[model samples]
Target: MNKTRSPIVQALLAEISTFDEAAAYRRMLPAGCYTEPEFFAFEQAEVFSRTWICVGRVEQVAERGDCFSWEVAGEPILVTRGEDGEVHALSAICRHRGEIIPCPEKGRALRCPLHFWTYDMQGRLAGAPRMGDAAAIATLRETVRLTQLRVELWHGFIFVNLDPDAKPLGPSLAKLEPLWAGYEATGVIDVPPAMSDTPLPWNWKVQVENFTDAYHPEFVHHGTHDFAPSIMPGDGVRFTDMKPGDNAIVRSVPMKTPDGGMMKDGWGPDAAFPAIATLTPEQRSRVTFAMLPPGMTMMFAPGTIAYTLIRPAGVTATYAGSDRVTYGGWLLPRSTIDLPDFRDRCAAVREGGSKIWAQDVPVNVGMQAAKNSRYLPEGIYGSLETTLQQFNVWLLEAYKRADQATR
Candidate 1:
C-alpha cells in the first residue's frame, strides 16, 4: 500500500487487494470507495488525471479558428482548430498571470480578459500588451506558448490526456472498432450534447453503473425499456470478453424487432429516426452499449449512435448530458438529417429519453445513498451484471497501478 494515500484510501486498497479476478466477480468494492472524500481525492490524482477523457466531438471544431473551452482533471483547457487545419488541445491558463482564457469569437485571437494578452488558435503567444520593449516582446512570443496536452480523435470523439507520456488511446479501444464501421459507412454527423447546468447528486461510478446494468430494466423501466428487453426468449444480453489492455465494458441486448430504436414512448419498433440502411442484419437486431471508463458511455442503436459524456465534480456529485440525460448527443447519417421532420424526430427522441431518465433518477439517488448505510452489503452480481463486474476490475487495475507507482 502507498503510504502517501489517506488512511481510508489505504484501507480500501488493502481490501481491494484481497479480491482476485474470479473473486472480484462475486463482490463489489468497499462502500467507502464510493462515499469517502479522501478516496475521491486519491482517484482524481491517480486515475482520472492519467486516463483518456472524452471532451467533445470533432465537428465542434471542424473549421480553422473554431475553438471551445473545457475542463479536464480540474485544469481548464482549450480545444481549437488551427490555421494548419489540425486540432490542438492547450491549457487555457494565460501564460502571464494564470487567468483562465476563454475561446474568443470566430476569426479573433484568444484574448485574456484581465490584460488582453492574446494567443493564436494553436496557443502560441501572439501579443502581450505593456510587458516589454520590441525585442523583449519577441522573446516572450518565442518562449511563452501555452502547455499542450495529448489529443487523439477516435471515431470523431475528441479525447485528451493530462499525462504527457501516457500511452495512446487507440489500442485500448480496439474492441469498439468493429462496431463503428457500419455507422461510419453511411457518413454519420455528430450533434454534440449540451451539458446540464446543475450536477446530479451521486458518485460518477454510480451514474455509469446504472447505465450499464442489464438486470434492472425489467423491474425499473417497465414501459420504456420493454422493447429492448435484457431477458429475451432465446437471446438475452450478450457480453464481450475483456482482455488485459481493454478499456471498454460492453453489453448488447436483442431488440424485439429489427431496426427498433427510441420512440416518443421509449425504445420501441417505431423509432423516431429511421434505421441506417448500411448496418449489418445483426447490428439492426441488437443495441450495444459501451462504457469507456472515467468519462463516456455510448449506445450503438439501429437509428442513431447515441452517447453521453460523464464529468465528475466531487465525491458524490457528477454532471452528465446526452440524449438520455439532456438532449442531442447523436450521430446520424445525412439521409436522416435530410428528412423534412428531422426536428420533430429529434424532439420525439428527447421525449422518449426523458421518460427513461425519470425512472433512473430515483434509483441512482437510492444507490448513492446506500453507500452511507452502516449495513451496506458486499453486493452480489448476477450473470446479467457482467459489465458492472468488468468496471470494478478496470477500476481496481487503475488503483493498483497508481499505488505501485507511488511505491
Candidate 2:
C-alpha cells in the first residue's frame, strides 16, 4: 500500500507548493484519491482527525447543559455547555475503563449510564462512588479526567480540534471574517440546523468539491437558477470563485420563489428580515452562501441566517453534523417572516438540498466508476473553479503533511 501511494504522495507534496498560478488549471487530483480505500484510511487519520472540524453552530450547546454529540474520524465526541456557561468538547468514551457512552443526554453532570461514573459538564471527574478512601480517591480523580478536545468559537460557529496543540481556528480563518462582515454587523442569529446524511458510494471529497465550486450548479443544480437566480451563469464571475488563503468559498445567488419569480431582494420588502440595512445596494440584490471546508457553512439571506455542518460518516456516508440537521437563525427585524414561517422556509431549503444532492451523488458515483476507464480525464479545471482548485490544493497539502507525519 505504501509503495503504491509513494509517487502520488510525493507529487501531492511537490505540486501543491510549486503549481504555477500562471499555468492552465486543467489538471485534476488523481482519480484514485476519490476511489481508493487505502487513501480513504489515510484521510480519516491524517486530515479529519488532526484538523479542527466544525460541529455546527454553538446554538447546539447554547444554554447551560445543552449538548451535541457525534462520531468523526472513528472517535466519538461529546460537546456541552457547563454551568459556568463555557462549552467543552471531550472524548465521549469514559475514562475509567474505555467504555463507550452514548451522549447529548443532559443533566447537571454527565453520568456514564453504564458504570455511574460522573463527570461535570466541563469534563472533570466529579464522582466515582465506592472506589476508594480519601487518599486513593484524590489520586484517581487526577488521573481520570476526560480527554478534552480543543474548542474554538467564531461568529457563533463551534469548531473542535482533536489535536490539542493545533493552531487557533480564528487566526487561521481571519481572512474569512471580511467575507462575513456585513452579515455579522447586522447581528446574525442561527436558524435551527437541519442535517441529513446523503449516502454516497464515492469518497466525501466529491461532495465538498460539489459544494465549493460554481461550475456544477450550471448543470447539476440547474433548477437552483430559477430560485437562486445568482446561479444563472454569465460572463460575470460567481462569488465562489476565489483565490487561496481566503479560507472561504462564498457564492452569490438571487432570492426567488420556487415558482420562478424574483423577489425585490432576498427577503422582499416585507420580510421579517426585510433586508440588512448595512448591505450595499449590490449586496442586497444577492444572498450569500459561504463555506469553510470539511464542515462549516452559513447561508446568509436578507431575511434570515442559517448555520450548517457536514462530517464524514465512515468512508462513504456523510453525516449532516446533528444526524439529520439542527438549524436556527435570527430574523431580520424589519422582515415580516414569522418564526413559524421562517422554520418552514428553512425546512424547504433543507429538503431542496436533499433533492439536489440526490443528483450529485449519482454523478459522483459515475465519476468514481469512471476512474477505471483509460479515457477518464484528470480534472480539467475551468476559470470559475479557482475556489474548487483552492480546496483541492488544501486537500493535497493535508495529505502531504499527513504523509510526512507518519514517516
Candidate 3:
C-alpha cells in the first residue's frame, strides 16, 4: 500500500481541506486539462483499465451459486458465487479460443456453449468434453482456470478490478471507514434495469463537478424552490473550504419555515430550498456528507437513512446509480420484497432529479467548449467546490501513474 502512495499525493491530501480562494487554485492548472483529447486517452488506458469499478449492485450476485456478468472498458467479466458461498470476480472469457462462458445471467456453473467446456462455481475446470487423452486432459486442466480479478464487498456494494495486481479495496479505502459508521441502510439493495438516460454533450468530469456544486441549488433547482413556499426567498448557500482530515460532517442546515417549525416534506415554503431533511437526526445534528472518491457521493442523516450515487461506467459516459438503504444489515431474498415497484419508485426519483439536472447540461457543455477558447483559461471554484478540487487532483494522479508506466 505504501508503494502506491506517492509523496505528492500525501502532501496534496494533507492540505486540501485548508485551501482557500478558488481563483488562486485555478491558476495552478495548465490550460486544456479538462477538455483535451490526450487526457481522455489516458483516462481510458490507465484509470478505467486498472481500477476496481463498482459496476453493479451487491444483490445482483448475492446468493450462493448465483452470478452476474457484465462488460467494462471492453473486457467481459463474470462475478460468481463459489461453493463456499463467497462471491468472486473472474474473467468471463474461456481460456480456449477466448469464447465467453456464464452466458445469459446467474447460473450454477460456467459452461461454454462453443466448446462444451464446463467450469464449476469456483471457476475450476469441471469438465472438458472433447479431445480427451491423458496428456490432453492434463494440459486442459492446467490451463483452463478462469482468470481471476480482485473483488471487494463493502457496505453491500460490489467492486471489481481488471488489474490482477491492484491492491485490495479495504486498505485503499481505510480513510473512509470511520465516516460510514452507524448509518442505517436497507440490508437489501438493488439497481433496477430501468434507468433514465440523460445524454449530456459535456465531458464526464463536468457532470461530476456539477454534483459537488451545491451553490447552484437555489438558482438551478428553481422548480424546487419556486413550488415550495417555506424557504427564504433567495439565500445562496455556499460551502466553505473542505479539509482533508476534517471529520466527515454535513454542512447545510435544513431550512425551516418562517413560523419556525419543521416542514413535513423537508422543504421550506421556498419550493427549491428544502429543509436539509435528507440527513438523519443524528447526522443532521452533526451536519456531514461523505464525499467518496473515484465517483460516489453519499448523504446520510444519522440513523434515519442514507443514499449513495455510484458511477458504474467510466468517464466518457458513466452510469449514476444509487442505493437508499438502512444500516440494519438484514438479508431477505428478492421474493420477500416488492422489488419491482420499489425499482419503479427509485427510477422516478432519479428521473425527476435528472430532469432538473438536464437544465445544467447545456451550461456544462458550453463550459467544456470554452475550455478551448482563450476566454476561459481556467475557472474559479468555491468552498462548495471542495469535492470538485478533490476529483481533479485524483484524476491528475491517476493520469500521472499511467503516463509514467507508458514512458
Q: Cα lDDT of all candidates, in order?
A: 0.92, 0.62, 0.52
Model 3 lDDT vs. the true structure?
0.52
Task: Rank by TM-score, highest first.
Answer: 1, 2, 3
Superior candidate under lDDT, 1 versus 2? 1
| Predicted candidate 3 versus true structure: per-residue lDDT over 1-407, tens digit per residue | 12353444333423432333443345434434455454444455567777666655567667777877766555788877788888888888887778888644455468898987888777888778776787897787777798887887876667787877776766665544654543323233343332224434555566556655555655766654333221344632324343532222233333333311112222234222122333245333332344445444544332222344444333244455432211121122233245455444334434444555566666676766776677654456655555556555555556555655654
What is the per-residue lDDT of model 1 for residues 1-407, given as tens digits with 9 covering 90 to 100? 77767898889988898888877788888999999999888888888889999999889999999999888877899999987899999999999999999999999999999999999998999999998899999999999998989999999899999998889999999998998888889999988898988899999999999999999999999999999999988888999999998989999999999999999999999999899988999999999999999899999999899999998889998889899888989999999999999999999999999999999999999999999899999988888999999998999899888888887
Model 1 C-alpha lDDT versus the unseen true structure: 0.92
Ranking 1 against 2 by TM-score, winner: 1
- Report residue 44 deviation for candidate 1 (angstroms): 1.5
How far off is residue 401 in model 1, in Å? 0.9
User: Candidate 3, which segments miss by more than 4 Å at Cα?
Assistant: 1-24, 27-38, 102-108, 171-179, 185-188, 191-200, 225-280, 284-291, 301-316, 322-351, 372-374
lDDT winner, 2 or 3: 2
Error of 1 at 106 (Å): 0.9
Ordered from best to worst lDDT, the candidate numbers read 1, 2, 3
Weakest lDDT window of 10 consecutive positions for candidate 2? 258-267
On TM-score, the candidate that comes out on top is 1
